[model samples]
Target: MEILRGTVAANAKPTKPSFVSYVTPEEIKSESPRPYTPKTVKCPHLLPGEVMFCSANTVVKETQDDLSQRGVFGTLLCTNFRVSFVSDEEPTEDTTQLFKNKLYGQNDIPLSCVDHIYGGYEDKRKLITTGSLVKNKCPSKLIFHCKDLRVFTFVLTYSEEKDAKMIFQGIVHHCLEPKSLKNLFAFSYCENTACPEKQRKQRTMMFDCAEDWDLDMKRSRGVCRLVTENNNFELSPDLPQFFIVPTHVTEADMCQFHGKGLPMWCWSHHSGCALFKTSTLPLLPEDTIAQAYMEKMLTAVAHNYLFSVKTEDLSDTLPTVQDIQLAYSKFKHFFLIDNTTDFWMSDMKWFSSLDSCGWLDIIRQCLQKALEVVECLETENTNVLITEESGSDLCCVISSLVQLMLDPFYRTLPGFQSLVQKEWVAGGHNFLDRCNQLHLKDKENTSPVFLLFLECVWQLLHQHAPAFQFSETYLTVLSDSIHVPVFSTFLFNTHHHRATVLRAESPHSQRDPLNCPTVWDWSVQFDCRAQDLFLNPLYTEKPKHVKSVQRSRPTHQRQLSLPTACKTPPKKGFFKDEADSLKKMLRVKRISRWMLSPETPHPSSATREFYETWQRKPLDHHGLILPCLDGPSVRVWLQRYLRWIQEVQIFGGGAVTVLGKVSELQGEVRELQRRLERHGGSSFSSSNQQQQRAIRARTGTSTGPQTGGSRSSVRMSSSFPFTTLKHNWSYKPAIPTSVLQSLMASGNLADKEDDADPESIV
Candidate 1:
């Protein structure tokens, strides 16, 4: 080893635990010529091509064990890849620099292993101290959370303060680097070398999604204990066009197994073809209209696409042709029962077990399945249509999720609110029955389907924090308002219902707080549960005002940097103002239409009033419109939505195409390697390094699965041709057929036929 040790004053014997070291205050002062000037350490053990960032005099502290012991004084080195520290123990010449001194023991940590870094003084902490109490310089320290769930703390004093800021910023910058498939799969060092087995397992799990799934085996085994613990509900039989929602698909799929309203889209290939979600016919035999409507809907789906799925289940108790009215009746009763239990029991002692609730489980299952359908449509470029007994409950959930996932615009606050309105509210997800069950009956056959949907959306908001405008608190309050009877959720089944209720009431009544409650009323609830539900852990506060840091910039540049209309705060209670504006716009449009055609008979007063009253307000803020939230929330939502639009509509296609190219390149590289192994060296042998580098550049593929070794590191090409990709600034961008069909291939088994007659069950 090439060792470069710094001068040390003491010759104390090394301790049993090699990492431990002790330095007295007098010794530390003697080592530093100036009290404020920290001794910098240059690491001699830097890996090949590793660049040193900065170094400082600090103390190494172990966080996990020996909590009461003081930190060991040392010289810390920060590099592009890792942080290393050298403690003072061995004696050397006083004239020699710290970097030349002999060290007792070294502690090194790789940057890739770090999960989070705290600078010790966050904005929230600074706000707590009054101006008089606040110090000119706060104590500097760094806290690191590692991927292995280990914590590291380093304390800095005197001259080390500046180094703390630099090191903290450097670590954060490294963490914020654009993550790729390779970085996600990269192996980390346990001590000094990589952990291979752990990396292999994680990478395998990631690739498992592409592998063929055995639904029957999982069903027979009852593989997931969580699913078996809940209920004896059997998995839906694998129909010709649709598969059962599997219990063992992923660990996250635990809460969503064997629940009702679970028809799923079936696709032989991931082509951007119209999705066919095959489901059981309705359970009720009273009415045949739903069945007829289903057939007509299926026909329309088929007519729109060249190839569509047809469901054929061999063994199942569900009816083939269901009656809509009776099916809806059962749905309504079930929904009501579930909602009542959730509303009451959520505040009760049994709230912990709510995840296992049969109704909640069904909602979770529907949401999970719906997300799967959406992934197929959006990421995989497949079009999907759902089929269910009444084509309402689960159908509504799946379709809503599909729309939200596929459209970047829907991910915005107003778009999300409008999505709920269009899907659950207007699309008829049995809100009336659920509300009636919650309001009228205390027990039996109630469901929390709407609340479940809210939770599902919350999950998305949690995962993609930037994509949502409203907080979890907003959703929780809206749900609680259903029980309170004042909010629109209780009195109105849909937007139309709410509009009707509003129009019927006098303007004076609408203005009063008690008489006319909007969704905003939920925010005023002071209950512990209400407060808890309102808090969103993932909401990132954006800077309200941008600072002009550069005064010397050109006039035009400064003008451009000024906050745009989107950034400007709207008037408070903007929803009310917007609503009034919409009403006026509708009236003007009506008047213009009347003036254009003089020969048309004059419309009735009631007809004119109804048109004016019932018209759906135009969606603004980039086609997103949140109901109760103000401009700030909507603005935050809009920012996220616009970014999402750019990602999905503009950059997303290129990523997909790149992914396809990478997949092809990997296959080619493997084939060539196989050929090289079988035969003697050829012309390809000379270009092997180039080929391997290209593969690594494109995909983060491992060199050998058995050893879990990588051939090359991930290389992110900054010049990736994003500008060459076609751009669409619209909220809804058109998808090309070729792009959609690029990755389509048949991997699933062919559809099977059933012995049971199609219409016999109903």
Candidate 2:
């Protein structure tokens, strides 16, 4: 007690919360001075101020520091289905009980449901003792939160002579049925010290994503009940959800949907996820031939990688997070190495899975073929087969490419042990630039079908990695820029790209006025009888339309097809809205609350392109109800201002864009006419004409190819367009600032030649 007290600031009273003063003992050093906090909601073993109840001599903040020979992470599997048989109402209770006892493992014994337990153990002193029974008295079930937003009830008793801890692994990754535990969701956080920029971004993103997702869920579930009683920011303590969702329906609706529905306001806004790049691989046009095999082939692919992907690493028989991260890392490297082995160069189960037994050889062959031009990647390669038919068998190319792009970034996430040496970030970005370069230099060496594989790989990396380097700059400004749409277009322009996860602040002026509600309208509001809530009464009448539409025609389509080059999309919710009027009637709930002084929406750089900033200064609040008005009509002055800004942002951009195009056309016309006079055999008179003729004659003479030509001879570069260039300067140059200042004596800071890298161009 004395030791803990002495560490506190000398002037501070003991009554203060530990956070205001240093509570960590001086003898122990923290991992990082900055003391980073996770922005995203996460449940690490030792969150700040968390304490494990103990009657020991002393307890240390670090669980590992206090315990001896303990695992940092743990897993425990529950095998007590018989415990639930008391629910006589469930008819399956008997069958479920028999099924539980009948369960068998690989050896086919009537196995114990809980075969193993994972957690930390302290062998030195049995700290958890009830009446000195030592470890034997430890409770098998201690309640705590999990990173995956789950609270499980474990029933196990500990028996250790010394103090011990059971490490709780983030997720349950054992038993074939564990995959069903996904009504639970997870998010990311930084375990790293805060000073690292990468960690900072990741931590912030995790929190922001969580917050935004929660808002979406609340809004969608019903008109969200987020408004505080008196405009308080302190969220209502009674908010029902623990984990964030895209949107959430109300409790009754949630129970009805098996506790699932996009959380209101939790719209990732993915319905119209802006296309950064068009998919080069369009949806395979419908055909009876491909449709018949599509499911079977897709099943084969999913089965080929038969291992279950856990949300987090469990410590039992299942592989750890570190292992999965490593496997992902390997998957990325496969893209870089030209002659990398096929079996398991990237994915751990690549060549080892039961279904992949015969597929590896075929994939290797595909890789060899993929390295050739677009035509060669097809099953029947011919120079003329450049259409979709040519590259019909594209799965192998996709698989290999996925390996190359994804593995490296996935290696950077929290559970993975690989240290992202500070120097590697630039190298990672350059990898993509380099790929573009190689592809341009030798078009036949790689093709877009393979690039789709690269995109798939990136998709995996984005999913697993904590930090995605979507943007970079030397200084002045930084943007969360994905220019993914740009790179993706180069892959294939056939299918719509689904990299639909991005949110950033943009200017308020840029948002779509229509999208902004004048009022914070609720998602739905209805009240009749709370008792018959879950039942759908309308199912009694079956619609005749379903009977007539048994065949596989595109369910509903626009009367006309789009241009052959792009897809034709129906501009409404393509997914069945369910049109459940009875469900809708039962679910409409009212606005829980509204603040008279509503707050301004936070600005986002990325989402602002179609975002509108709304504030309720006075009239817009539309208190309780307005006479004969659906929404309050603003006085003439403000209404005009709102319309003006909205129209300018949405329509002004179009005008400026059109003006710029016209100017460009004018400049091009003048340049072309000048070129015609100089090279298009235009007859001219006078001395200027004579000079022009001489230039034309020289151009004609130099038109033929020259051997061993100098760069001054003006030959077109063979490399394709837009690949990044690498400079190979002969001399190491001194900084211009240093040279100029020194040479100027009484001083000027300016380059003698041109300012190569403009720090301030203006």
Candidate 3:
């Protein structure tokens, strides 16, 4: 296209000029129009048939191509498509318009090209003038932040404030408004004004052709690779192709393998990391097969941006590492007198078990393994493939721990249970077989994987108590539900696994989705207790569009032993005396260690009388106790058990309630302290000033050479030419009653939805 300058149309009307143009003598003379001048004419530079919305008579400061303002002035004219400035000096007939009418020191900037507007000054209303102040200063600068984060500043003179505000708001409006499809196609009404119908038909035909071409090309491309996982052909010949993990399995990537394969689930980070849990080779022993399939899965990542990881060597695989973890668990289980053995154990025997079991050591090991898997996914950005002999044991342990660590949603009760459903119950962890083994005392098959995961979660909750809503009571009750079989975790395994178990138990039982129990049933059995433990009181759901807060690892502190004996509270709630008495008895049964004496002592009448009023099973008890067990031992357990009513109903501090309001209050205090530091006295002002100083320091010198001569003499803003534009633009439209009401209604509805399911991911 050839460049055009100040040349006028041959048929140009003798109307007044709306814009002040420097190249045209007629337009330049109009800038200083006489009292009886005719109405303003359209800007000469505007395209044919383009309309002018408005124009203002204001002085413009010429700027370098670097966007630095120069010591030059001109009259500015803004049209629909572009903003053009004319030289301040009156044009003479001898002055030649270079390259058509492209005048020296004139800028024609397209309205479509402006990208951003920055206004950082604080509200002027706050800066009030005290007694007898003649005038108040207001910030009059606005910097436009545009493509490539480049900046240009503008300043409005006090006299032209009204015009400056209008132009500023208009430019911003043009920048934000979505461009119409017609604009994108460069179709204009003027192009077909002479034959409107014919032009419309041609435009429509062109659009139709483009649409058909795009459709055909897309159809030929087939489904996007992102949604499919069958790209890689690598698999073991003996194994089914479907058994291997998919190459790219994001959290949003759904499964298409009939609910098997244990597809890897990637988080939406650019780190190319993923997590998957798969069953070990059923026909091969753990030591015999190398986890080369894992490496193969990872190899696909180079092409697909997927990630997969496996333990480095066979020696460090789940079977060997978890074997050592389970050994420690067995050692503790062998000594501890749980509910099954509680009826038979003497006081001395119980004490000996508690003292010798070293349960804390097991807890430590469980925590370490969980942390290792978490670190892999988070810190190292490594993908992980966790597999065990049956996939239900240690594999379940690792998968659940990793999800809980990374997905903050699982920190709440419903989220926790959804994770259980997705990861354990639905993922095919053999809850039935494992719980059965524990019940039957089958040492070999019984793994402490579930317990290990719970302990790991406990460590996190214990440290970063504010980050989670559910208390330790929730975890304790959840663990208890496993033994209680009626809970869904124990009742339902995978569809095939559950179906098999049900078929054997009752051949005619219906196996429909409706017949299966949901995890919500926990509320049905113990509504009050479930509500207390299952929902977090501290959790505040953020809007769905809000970016999630980055989670930080809980600080590690030296693990503390369980308090040996409960000390009576100096002051308490209304039921303080009852609470202390019950706590004292509970602590004795839970943590006290007695010397092993052969003597069997008789119970006191007072203790016997106290025990008679309580008969129900203890909520926190893991050990089974026969009804025939002696009264004193039973009394100690029952008094604390009865206190659950007082605790739950009155004080809300049952034995199961681990972390109390004191810690929650502390967290709030810390948050307030941070806010204080952030907004204290002069700190906020000082910080804001520091940022302003930094921005000003980077601004180029405002004075530069005059307008273009040769290309080498012209300085551009980086590689692109830019003309600095002004600040102090304000646009505040009055809110309509209908719009205000609608906004309020929508906000209220969102709050209601949030309240309905407080634990849900917002």
Candidate 4:
């Protein structure tokens, strides 16, 4: 019976099992988890008044290193403040970094900083201009070229179509198509930013008011007086509200040509000569009256303080604004590279490319022009009037260069900032138009005039390192800050424009934008640690005794009395013999009188004396400095142009190695001095005296060219061009033990076999 049941069970096993359903299909579908879809992620950090306009998720940021071809998954965002990318992966912070920017992060690019934007689709790229978003389809890739030579690329293939389109449109609209100056982020930021009064007081001089001008004049011992005729900007919108003019000129003279073609005082020299700048009169050859008046105005300028004036037409001497723009346009391409292949491909023809660009030629021309002006003031004892078409472009350039060369006050950090304010901002340079901050697409109005001036300054700083109190890093950072919208220093075209903007009401809020901070307020962008990079450690302060000596020197007094009238020659009448006898007597009297008069100093001897005095004086950083205008003397600014390129970064090498060693030696000496003070104060004082004597003795010898009492040494490795162990024995270890230990812990340092001898290792 059991065998029969088993057979039946086996035959019935193929029947399907019965089931009962408790849940409906619709309910199951609703309860189940949905597929993962990218969603908009809000930006974690925003400025005081920043507003996010659009965002796209699942974006990929392409790394600049073309060899790696790596991509970072992130979310791309567009706000009024900047274009930012937030990565999905947690960012690993480098604690070892000595300097860090607080205003902008690694993935952030300010809207004003965006020089050009390109969109790529199907292996083709096109510039994204105004209304391009409406004319073309949404691009899969967007590339940003910044004014600071930074390039950023973002891929939007993984993002939703609508989200991608929204972000692209948002960036183009806000970054390139602002309708008015009020729309800039500066006004909004100023509205919300609560700048401390103490901090504002400590910032650089703006030269925006009459008091600042007065203070500047007093500092320079200027003989000209400040005029407030343009208090309401009535004379000319381009001219400052308050400016210095010759004592001979009146308010009525300033009204001529809307304040154009009038000599305005820039600075005064110790030799009773002054530097002046003016705008060119309109090119109306047919208007003889205007030309005649211009001549008369210039003649009056020449008589200022009873000194002759030399007029330098910069438009005739230096490159035109258009020429500058063209040269810079071609020059910037070699550095704004997207891939390693292109960079290396262009490296072989670098010098030829640079020459063809004509940028260095422009720099040379500017330096030559400044040197000429310096000669006029220093040697010729004549006032120099630098004139250009607008007086805002090259006028600012040449005038600023002259001051930097002749005036020691302009070489320090604060003085440099003040010089920029006086020459560029207060001088009415069209920074808004030149920098294209509004992205107006007006090519004629855009030129890197300020950058050219900075380049010229860099040349001086490079040639005379110890003369400047600021480092090259400071200049590099300052150049980058020009595009940052938070600073009011480079925002407007003129003092009047800045004033108008500050008083105007913001569209976003009821607050006035009067408290906008300037770039000199470094606290807004950098912490104290980063701010230290702006100061040069090798700077030697100008001696106090030198200033006193300059002040004590008697001012040169010129002969102010009118010459004696000459008696008319005896008329040759009937008594011709008598007339000849009278002329003979007069000639003999003049000869006797000339012979009896006191002997005067020869002009050449006076010049030789001046040269000897200048040479004999101990080197003064604040004294006259001449630059080498030779071809080989002009060098590329490596720290600026190549800083962004990773391949050119020489880790633990270059001048930094020598600078580090010097810093260590300085610390050791300081420590020793402190110990000696604790042990024997008198011995420490004697040691200081001995050091001073040694320095004086070293400076007295004419062994080599000197700058600031010390020979100008080339900043390079002591064992340059060779890698022998004997030559490198004097150098400290390149990497510290602590750094090596950390690198090992991070698995970044590779282990190597000990193949060298123990003596060589030591």
Candidate 5:
């Protein structure tokens, strides 16, 4: 290596090579520069008139699955319409999603859907109600429990203290404590120009006007006459302006109790019997005057042409509204799980816990009551008069259920909507109070009566899937729609209340609330493709030629007639011995005639004939359908309750799979029909036959197992795609005896060993 020396001495000063500078040193050193302006946060898309009140950066935890979760950094926004979370990391579109909702995004929860809010601080979580939030500081974590059985968690640990507090208070005030009905997002949405006109693929009878009610009366072939006595709501606020009562019931009968205890016609059976619902009479002295009025009102209802009325006191037979509230409160807790640990912990004893909740038991009781009313109408040929504290609650439930089972028309999608309109909306159920739409915190008034009705309907749909034109998905979505305030269908307590709200002008704006949309217009939420999921492909329509037969009335009243008594045995041989022999002879005679038919056909021959005719009918969808009330038959609606639980979801299972298979088969059938038409009844060519054979082979062939003696055996394995061989099946062991024993001993499964391996022992 060679050493080199610099041209100048090391001690000499160096000169700087200068270039032009854009800013001077004085300008750069200025203490007061342009006022700092923070970049604006991009909010998620809002509804037409939805206004964002506050927002904060939050780490959203994936609570869908408990075992593993990744936090998504997003801005949590509180809008008038909903609580939305916007994340840059989330994909804009999911190709795998089969059902897409236009009204709500995956992270969007409607303000009305917010059933309960919880705050977490220092590892402890407490309910964040309006009253509690007033004095409490903002929490580091926030959780939302929704009416649709959805749970969301947001972490505010990384957010600014002020931002977190602002967002927390905003959500609490807007969601849990709305001041009036006008404040609901629905009114705002109606005012916006973006809100579209009511669009419906199918015609749904709203029963909002007299024409709809008249059409229903004509369709049911009802004998009752419609009255406009309450046209201006001068008679009763709870009743619709236009309603049909028994023909003999006069305006004076309706005036009593303000339409209470007035039997209103629900539907007419083909047998000339009808269903009626009335509210209970006011408490009065058990004197002659009260009794006289009650007798006169009931007499008018019973005297209706061709109706022998049987009064059913629903309050005495069915579970009370308070009981339903308590049961549902306990039942919903099992589903509102925050983490995998809590989910698994609850899953272990889900059945027993569900039973203890009493919800399913209530469902069973409601079904049994409906069946009793059905029996009276179908077999006894007597009209039913259902009375309750408020005819709107259980009365609507049983009436709707009766129509579903008795009238095939109600099983159809349009008819189902019409039934809800007729019995619930037109009947004036207090949906606003019962659903807690205003977030009033009135525990006594808030109950899941409508939810209970839906659950009952689910049972019927599950047991008789093909009987209904609508799918379980329809019911599930309809249940969620109740919490969405955009629907005027369930927003008000009475018809008059709805009318007043709709016609009333806003003081703050010139918008008309009358334009508020109804839930029946499904296009407001889902497009045609998405709406197709609501129709069941398996439903077979009733044959037009088939009609319910009207049987003639019996000449004499039927009574329990005992077998003709045999002649008293004559005193024979010596006293006691002769008596024993005579008794034995009498017993023999009764046993011999037991197998023989009655000398005269029983007076219930009409009932038996009707039942036999129903059984012989090719279509079971239109005729009477009795629900199986056995314990095993009353099942949890898994589609509605567990749809969000990722672990419980089957990868390639559920109704979607069945629907796909059905569609494929239908396509094949159509293709074959077209080919046959093209061939003009000629046989297929050899090549065509070969192609068909190949198609069949790919689809798999089904063969019936051969019978060997009394039993017909099923093959253990098949060529079907879903069929699995016995050896290929995997066995999952039950919970270890020690864990169960620990649970029994300690009354808590959490006390068991955490490290215990399930497969190792049990």
Candidate 6:
């Protein structure tokens, strides 16, 4: 594709009209541009593929390693439009239902209908902790609610550490002309004699053609192409030409976009921005963390100027810290609030003194420069929602107090560690302590903010003031005022346990691809979240990802105490008057003094009522609430985990012991019977005589020997014989004993019936 000097390849022949189509280089060289010191280029308006003069797009490398492309995609926050609707406050069931119904249009918005989204910030004058303004600020939202409304969103995202911000707000305002359908060099017929394939696709895009700017030239930005355009390029001509348009626009000229011959045209939007800020600290007295606080303050303060949808690069014109502080010094006394110039202005007066009182007078003379930046907003009917910021809201108020206390430093000749800068040693009074002295003021009847201010001031004095016994007392007073977080979220919450970066090969390394652990210091953040708010210290074994521990929690544990009496609002929202009865039931019943008196007292109706009331929810109860070390409470609970494990061990051990004992008892019984059988009628003394008699009688007859004392003794002595004889009628033990002779002498039968041969012999 070939690029012409200024006009598209619409001419049939080098017609006379070619002279009238575009401004020539002679005309460009003759004119000068507006609002410029540097960074301004000659505005070019050439059609794609027609090369003429000024090698603007010729690829070139610069002084720095970064290739500075002449054309990079950028956002322009220049649009201004309005739309109105009701804003829903908190997301409610009914509100959600309504939102769903309204999300899609009941009918299409015709090309004729025009819609918009624009907002502005107000001079909140929120005194910040820092003396500096926030950096890389973006606009906050104020949504619009309507019966049939839908909004397309654009976001610019990047990291402060990386010094980058991707912006996408400019495309909203750019208009695409709907009339011109053809003549765009889409796939082209470049009859340029310089080309082999004379008719080819031209690189001059529709967006680049109208805007006269190209952004693909930036290395970080990579490649991009126009997504929405009509396909209409003729591929014939007996002549030659080129196509490749420049991509950039001057303030005076707007883009003339390609169209589809309809009432409207479509343009795709995309963007991002990268900035380079030295990784070095710039403050003379303060540290980096303190500097970050100032940046936040600036963001909160300069909310309005940043609301423009067009994302413009203001880094070139942005003032340095010193210049900004000077602006504050100049503008401080001009605006009045309450009866005083206020601490912010007073600090401004001290930190950066105006060269002359006249210069100061200009500030005093001016009405309100802060408001000038903000007054563009028109609130929509949409509901506003509030969520807690990631960091402490309490810190914001504290920072303002510190700034107020440091006002005197602004005026001192040396100025915020100038002595340290000169001598390389800290000598001036500490800024942290100097700022906290404001707490000495009487705090009675102070507003919430005023009370917080007093607390913040007191704390600073305690931290940096001369070591004194009174400081602890001041701390006690401060503790009564604010509930500060225990740990710093940035230190512990974002980074790894240790401060060193992890390498992949080290076993302790946290650089596993799965976790992508950070190398930041996590101690401050961990302790703050753990020991301060929640007692379980946040322990991270692997920097890549910290696994959360789950302690068994009671299902009905009461989180807070309930109110003593009912004071429900008529139409309270969900959070305003939630159920408190459930909170009371979780508390354990306690034995009161009345129940433990010296004498047993008779039951009273009131006592019964008290006991019945114990049935109420824990939070609903009125007495003996647990106090936390900080604001969040530590719940005391009894765990049965260890006891359950012990019980299982004991039961299992006892069962095995009992089974063994039973087996041993059975074996012992068998051994005793065997011994008795082996003994028979021998190995016995006089006591054995009874055993012998019993054996002789039992062997003779089953029921024959009804024993007297001697026979019973004999039968009792024979363990095995007794057991066997009870169940069966056995003949004899192995031989008859001499005790049988004694029984016969006593005139006992002695089983004569079985001794037939003996009787014959007798």
The number of the candidate with the highest TM-score is 5
Better of 4 and 5 by lDDT: 4
- Which regions in candidate 1 have their CA more than 4 angstroms from the true location? 1-293, 307-364, 379-382, 442-445, 494-517, 520-762
Using lDDT, give the best candidate's number. 4
lDDT of 6 at 675: 82
Q: After superposition, which runs of candidate 4 have C-alpha atoms over 4 Å from their true positions?
A: 1-42, 92-97, 198-203, 283-286, 506-513, 544-619, 668-762
Instruction: For each candidate in the order shown, give its overall lDDT on alpha carbons.
Output: 0.37, 0.22, 0.37, 0.71, 0.70, 0.21
- Poorest 10 consecutive residues of model 3 by lDDT? 587-596
Q: What tens-digit string does per-residue lDDT give for candidate 6 at 450-497?
A: 222333333333233321112222222122212111111111111121
**lDDT of candidate 2 over 78-137, digit per residue (tens):** 221101101112232132110021111111111112212222233332222122233243
lDDT of 6: 0.21
lDDT of 1 by residue, 285-352 (tens): 66565554444444434322222323322112122122222332333221121112222222222323
Error of 1 at 18 (Å): 84
Better structure of 2 and 3 per TM-score: 3
- Model 5 / residue 77 / CA error / Å: 0.7
Candidate 4 lDDT over residue span 566-680, tens digit each: 2322333533445444433221111112223468344334434444545565666656766676687888887778766554555446655556555556547757867876876
Model 3, runs deviating above 4 Å: 1-245, 248-263, 266-270, 282-295, 301-359, 437-443, 500-514, 528-530, 536-762
RMSD of 4: 14.0
* TM-score-superior candidate, 1 or 4: 4
Instruction: Report the number of backbone clashes for model 6.
Output: 63
Compute the lDDT for candidate 5. 0.70
TM-score of 2: 0.18
Clashes of each: 22, 61, 14, 0, 1, 63
